[model samples]
Target: MLNADTTDPAVLRELIAGELAAARERTGRLTDCVEDDELVAQHSPLMSPLVWDLAHIGNQEELWLLRNVGGRDPMHPEIDPLYDAFEHPRSERPSLPLLPPKEARGYAHDVRGRVLDLLAASPLEGSPLLDAGFAFGMIVQHEQQHDETMLITHQLRKGPAALTAPAPPDHADRLPAEVLVPAGPFTMGTDTEPWALDNERPAHRVELPAYWLDTAPVSNAAYQVFIADGGYDDPRWWTERGWAHRQQAGLAAPLFWSLDGGQWMRRRFGTLEPVPPREPVLHVSWYEADAYARWAGRRLPTEAEWEKAARHDPATGRSRRFPWGDESPTPAHANLGQQHLQPAPVGSYPAGQSPYGVRQLIGDVWEWTSSDFHGYPGFRVWPYKEYSEVFFGPEYKVLRGGSFAVAPVACRGTFRNWDYPVRRQIFSGFRTARDAGEEA
Candidate 1:
């Protein structure tokens, strides 16, 4: 439930100003300890150069929100050719000539300031300029996106020494295994929402029969049962593709896991410690989730079913941006803001439960769905063509919600992300669902 009055020009300006301030502060922290040369070095495959990423954020705002709508020239016309991400995809990222680190930071600060001033002076409410609102939204999401990436990237470069240790896992209690959802029609996506990505538009109707979904993400203790039962060795539990992948890679369990003195230990950040049975299982790919589901006599929910259980407020036909409604996220609500930067004990945030009583729906670990990564009925390409069109096929599967490293704003209920079936470096996990009338 976003402020329905977000369209108020003054409110929008103030919001934009606040977000700009936050972005600057976060970005400053990311670059604070880096040297001039280190900023341009390729730290990891998951991250781009810090200097390049910083410039891209500012240039993106100028290109899409200001130039596209306000018809203004770029603050630095010459740098636009080098730093524009929309024009250069990730594959070409390494080859781009980058600005000096200090210069890049200054350019970003200058551009952000100019954009804020422009937004303050413009009449955005009813004018055609209103469409730029989406661009503003996009910029906000983009900045948060990099903030999360920076966290992971820093870990890769400096090892786990860069991050603070997470709180010890709590296994003192375990929640009920499942919650039953009644049979009904739940709106699947957004239609006329003030701001929605193209993938979330044309809010179509979907009817799902009654089902029982896990009240929380699968826990380490449960997944350990799968491993102990030789679940990975049994071909019957895996799809043909999954079996092939398992055999080819000799994967016996989740990455970053091992046995120590017959007890399970997992790698978090960089330290190895006893596996916390209550923590949601993580780093499992879609194939792994599917295999685990099959072994458990259940299945991953379709994106529609997942949304019906996790977002739709049956009483009002409205969905929350987060499972907990419109309030900005807090550490108490979910495992966001790098609070722990590791999966929390499942069901740790009862306040973050969705309307239908689905717990941990917003964050803990991203959940895999059975949906293919495809666009909606009237899908049209945005400025970044590669964003959606290139990934449309069986090669990728849809993932819902956000992971520990996810930024709060980027974890909105309708924001969609996709990954290849076998790539599982991300902090991903799954919950099980059974058909109507099934026993928990």
Candidate 2:
């Protein structure tokens, strides 16, 4: 949402300040909803204790904006190693000496207060980190990403439902099952986005063959059919690696799902309910997505293909920053920013559809693509390489679009998310794509 168009420093200050405030507000809500003991406890080995994230966000802000950019000394330098993500894995974090919930909150708030003061005095230009308020924007994004991580911790926590929101609106009309995306060249990455991280840089052109993409993300009803057809048992529907993982992990269905009284039920945030027939399937691993696509005689879209479907507007021969256009997301455009606890129905968010009439391309659940997590041509490390560079390899698969847990500041057409192929604890889903043939 932080565009490169702002030249007025005062307005830029206000914009950056507002986004930072919004992120902190959400962070506060997610942490404050639970008690101190809950914040300190690691609900799952896959996630860090919520308290670590609370103070870490502040530590990163202190390291970057306050010290690196603002020339201020670290407020709590002795605890830096404890909060460094790379220094300690999520599973081992709880054993480290961590700040308590109250102290973490105070540290984060104090860091924020100082950062805002720095924002007011800085020129916000003339340097790569300060130009377009990129550093501040990055910190805001970093915090929001942590906020999403904390929300996932909330989901992983065992308790009564601690979160609630109104359901997404229904789309009155049914949508077609597929939309045709013509084969052509489209820009694959962004060189101009103010806050776009290093990986989505050095804009380059990519050519893709014509393909038919699902009009909406694969729905629970459709995925149920796959499960019913013994999709998980059919080795033919899975790649060798996928089959191996499926068997090794005993993956019978999406995470949080169970069968009860012949009804498909799932635990959401702590409440068990029948799987919503029309919502996009959630918490599926990339391999499972691939297997499901194979079961349906289709395939997961390539990263380029997914981007084209979400961004390219052939009529104008240009790409938009989001499926709906270059504007920041609104509640009506997509189910983003924790606005809803789960995905909207498949046919919903008509306004959020891409030019090709592809719906839910930006949010609801991150759609897995059949692509490796490698950088594009001319990709260069910025600020630091550890954020993305260390993860570049076939060991990880890429996921496109944001999820309902995503903050709008961290979600955009060019945004890239990657996770290990077998990991499904994260909110993830997929829509199938097929090559065009005589059916076209």
- TM-score of every model versus the real structure: 0.89, 0.98
lDDT (Cα, tens digit) per residue for candidate 2, span 72-170: 977888999999999999999999999998889999899999999999999999899999999999999999999999988998999998888888788
List ranges where model 2 is wrong by over 4 Å: 438-440
User: Please, what is the whole-model Cα lDDT of each candidate in the order they appear?
Assistant: 0.76, 0.92
Output the lDDT of residue 26, model 1.
Answer: 76
Error of 2 at 417 (Å): 0.2
Best by TM-score: 2
Tens digit per residue, CA lDDT, model 1, 1-440: 12445766677778767776776677777777667766787776655777788888777778877787678876778878787656776556667877777787787777777787777777765543355366666677788778766765665564444456467234323567787878878667676455566677667677788888888899999999999999999999999999999999888888778898899987766677898888889888898899999999999988887887877887887666668876767777778756676787877787778877777787778899988999877777764666678878889899998887776767777778888888667778999899976655
TM-score of 2: 0.98
Q: Report lDDT (Cα) of residue 69, candidate 1.
A: 66
> Which residue segments of model 1 deviate by more than 4 Å?
33-38, 75-92, 126-132, 158-160, 165-174, 316-318, 380-384, 437-440
